[model samples]
Target chain A: MRTLTVELGERSYPIYIGQGLLQNIASFFEKHQITKKSPLFIITDTHVAPHYLNDVETNLHKAGYTVISAVVESGEQSKSLAVYEQMMTKAIEAGLDRSSTVIALGGGVVGDLAGFVAATYMRGVRFVQIPTTILAHDSSVGGKVAVNHPLAKNMIGVFHQPVMVLYDTSTLQTLPIREVRAGLAEMVKHGLIWDEAFARWCDQHAEDLLALDPETLAYGLEKGCSIKAQIVSRDERENDLRAILNLGHTLGHAIEATAGYGEFLHGEAISIGMAGAALLAVQLGADPSLYTETKRILERFGLPTVMPKHLDTDQVMNAMMHDKKFKEGNMVYIVPKAIGQVYIDTNMKVSAVRNMVERLKEGDIHV
Target chain B: MRTLTVELGERSYPIYIGQGLLQNIASFFEKHQITKKSPLFIITDTHVAPHYLNDVETNLHKAGYTVISAVVESGEQSKSLAVYEQMMTKAIEAGLDRSSTVIALGGGVVGDLAGFVAATYMRGVRFVQIPTTILAHDSSVGGKVAVNHPLAKNMIGVFHQPVMVLYDTSTLQTLPIREVRAGLAEMVKHGLIWDEAFARWCDQHAEDLLALDPETLAYGLEKGCSIKAQIVSRDERENDLRAILNLGHTLGHAIEATAGYGEFLHGEAISIGMAGAALLAVQLGADPSLYTETKRILERFGLPTVMPKHLDTDQVMNAMMHDKKFKEGNMVYIVPKAIGQVYIDTNMKVSAVRNMVERLKEGDIHV
Candidate 1:
């Protein structure tokens, strides 16, 4: 297994990535001097529990740990206050304590919701991320866990890092094609912000990745995690460099909100959002040629490149206004200056963004 | 105004403690370089709203801030998932953004719930504490915000620090006598863990404090905040030294849980819990004389020296088992090593705790 450390001083932890990492989770517990009997609370979504919960439970039990699991519903809706309540109740009923460790098993939704639970439950507790989806490659590493409010996505959450992340790529074999595409969007995002070579590599091996070729998938995951690790280490709280990671996320989050959560997968929204961002970059005189190339590569991966027909431009603008990147009523868009560089622009006018939204609605962009 | 820094590195913020701190809140905003038109969400509980809501609103309006207020019901029950949902909705409707600031304007419950709202809103946002109750002197300054679940007190929350704390002591003038006594329990605890002089001062002037004398009250508030601030600076996440702040809270939280929240104020239960810890300390051979003196002093302040008669020992024990401090199936007790020092004992047997409960029932210790 290869280990990547997310350094945040004392709050730092390692992300272990490789095949069959789940088999040796007990070793991780042992290394941390945490035992199987250390009051383990496993949080998984309904989608994941049916597939991997028993294996995890069996392994934990064999390692001499008492295990209790809380399974939330599967989907974006699961990341709500209602589910957070259910999970906390289940955890309390199962007797989780300060020394107890929570293992979040599933995709981004499960990881984010469960991580928030661990961050708040009993003030805080040790948490482990056993990500079962490709999207979690980003969510699991960053320690930014949160649930969504009905009014906003991820409106309620915390930046509580996991003690360890057991990213067993073997688990991804079970993911649906759509999920794989979602994960690829983030991998592309990593390259767009920091590494041109990795982005080119993804473009070359997109087919290999789609086919679930182990080597190609592993390479992508590792490179994406490494780039994220470096950025998080310098700006753990997203004060500067970290905001670049939100390349497609600003408009992407707005799309997700306007289209209604679960209508478009997070990565799908981001794929289209990236297109919008790239187009906006060109509008601001940042080389429209590079934007076209980026859009072509994203579409080749089967990622969406257009806005959903039903979403209102005005509503989308309102949603963007609520984005965390907005400063003093001004929307701060993280637009790319080039393929391997981006900048946060607080001076961007809403009129420009609205115009772009109108163009998106008119099918000015290609998928 | 007296300014004290929480010293939590990047998360560090200033606590402005004095009469009329609320009137000049715009200056604090200016110091942080926050704008007057910044979207600010003011969170308060029913009990505190009628007293200070209009004034706080007027101040924010006069300072040109686009302010909105969300008022939850008073009491521990208000710290539930339902209330959090309502608050978030209100915040979203009022256009609270990532750069927007949430001002928690009430006692501990409001501070915890509002702080948590800010922590999770849009992944996180800036929050300021405008604590009106004396009990909040401890809760507001330390960034230890949480909302209690039905099964556990503060079982759901986060350690989200505020950007600023506006502690207007004048608001405490109208506080009920019971609340004054309750808030003193924490002041006494601060002294027990760090400063013996402060403890002795509380003991000697317990009556003056109970009467809400401005000088004594202000001294206790400042001392408590300073001690907590020092500990928080060294251990913001409560990994080590900060655990000392929870000296009486291990059992204190259990009492609040078993006694059915809101039946006894947090401090009142903590007062009883401190007596339990003192008894345990004596039994463990950690200077029995100190236990007698501590109990006498607590009684002089009109704090409870025993658990309420209606509470069952077994029920309390069961609740204690669910405490977050429990490690490896063993509960870690913070027993006093002396009047001004304490040690965490993980080896303490459950049987010993049970025996102490029996002793209390038989009137073996003064109530």
Candidate 2:
């Protein structure tokens, strides 16, 4: 196993990445000084429980943990106030304490929801992310954990970093094809924001990654997590540098909210949001050629290039206004300067965004 | 206005305490470089809104802010998942951005609920506390903001500090007598935990403070906030020194949860919790005389000596397990070392707690 430390001083923790990390749960807990006597709460979703919950439970039991499980429904809906409350009730019922470590074992939805539960449960507790899907590579690394409010997606949450993350790439073999495609979008995003070489690598190895080649997948996950770790360390609370990580997310969040969650996966929404952002960048005088190339690469990964046809342009504009990135009542879109560079631009106006949405609604782009 | 800084480095903010601090809201905004166009959301509750909302709103408006207000029902009940969600929706509707600041203008309940709203809303935002009640002298200074779950009080929340705290002591004159007594308990608590001189001062002048004499009241508020600021600065997240602030809260929270919320003011519950903690300390070989003095002083202030008769010991014990301070399924109680020193003792077992509860139930020695 290779360990990467997310340097947050006392709040710092390790991300153990490799095969069979799950089988060595005892040592992982020992290293963190988390023992069986510690109130250990495992959070998994409905879909994940049937697949891997027993293995996790048995391993934890063997390690002498007084383990309890909180299984939430599997969907975007689970990232709501109701589900959050249920998880808290479960933790309370199961006797979770401050020293109790919560193990979140599932995909992006489970990771975000469970991480958020740990963040707010009894004013925060230590949590470990045992990500079971390809998409969790992004969610598990960043300290950003939130649940979606009905009015807005991810409107409620906290930046609670995990104590440890065991990203066993072997788990990705169970992920559906669409899920793999969604996960690749974030890999592409990591490249677009900071690393051109990684982007080029994705361009060359997208098929290999889709085919579940552990070596290529592990390489992508490490590079993505490393880039995210460096950014989060400098700006854990997203004061400045961390905002860059939300390159496509400003518009991506709006698309997710407008389309209604679960209609488009988070990565899929980001894919289309990146397209909108790229076009907006071109309109605002960024190089047109780089924008074109970025869109081309996203399309090659089987990600959506256009907004959902049924979404109302005005509603999407209203949704963008609710984005956390919106500053001074104006939307701040992070646009690309080139394939490997992005910048936050707050000068974008409502009318300009409206016009862009109108163009997309009119089907002016290729599918 | 007397300005005191809670020195938490970059997270540090000034607490402006005195009469008519509300009039200087514009100046505070200027010093913070906050502009009127920033998405500003003011969170208040029913009890406080009728008195101070207009003045706060007018000042913020004059300062050129696009101000929006979110009001919840006034009480401990407001600090729950249901109300938190409603406030989040209001923030979303008002277009609150990450750059937006949430101004919490009420007592501890409102401060905690609103501060938590800021903490989780968009994964955290700038929040300012404009405390109108005396109880806030303690709550506002510490960066501890949280909402209670059904099974546990403060069972769901985060440790997000405010950008500034505007403590307008003039607003306390409108408070009820019971509320005044409740607020004084925390001041007494601060003295007991860190300053014996202040504790003696409180003991001597308890009647003057109860009468709301401005000189005595202001001095108490200032000294209490200073001591709290010192502790919080050294331990913002309650990892060590900050836990001292929760001196009576372990059992206090359990009693509050068991009795059902809104039945007793936080200080009242804490008053009982302190008594229970003192008894436990004496049993564990700390100074028994110190425990007697604590009980005497609390009784002198008209705080409840006995746990409310209706609460079940088992239920309270269950609630204790949910406290954020509980480590390894064992409750960690903050016990007094002497008149002014507090030490965390985590070695106590549940059977000892049960025996103590049994004694309290049997009317053993006036709590």
Across residues A223-323, which tens digit of lDDT does each residue of candidate 1 receive?
99999999999998777788889999988999998888889999999998888888888887777686788888898789988877789888998888776
lDDT of 2 by residue, B82-185 (tens): 88888988888877777788989899999999999989888888889998888899999877889888887887888888888888888888999899888888
lDDT of 2 at B293: 92
User: DockQ for all models, in order?
Assistant: 0.70, 0.78
RMSD of each: 2.5, 2.4
TM-score of each: 0.94, 0.95
**Candidate-wise lDDT, in order:** 0.84, 0.83
Docking class of 1: medium
TM-score of chain A of each: 0.97, 0.96
Model 2 error, position A101 (Å): 1.2
Query: Any runs in candidate 2 off by more than 4 Å, and if so which?
Result: A7-10, A285-288, A361-367, B282-291, B361-367
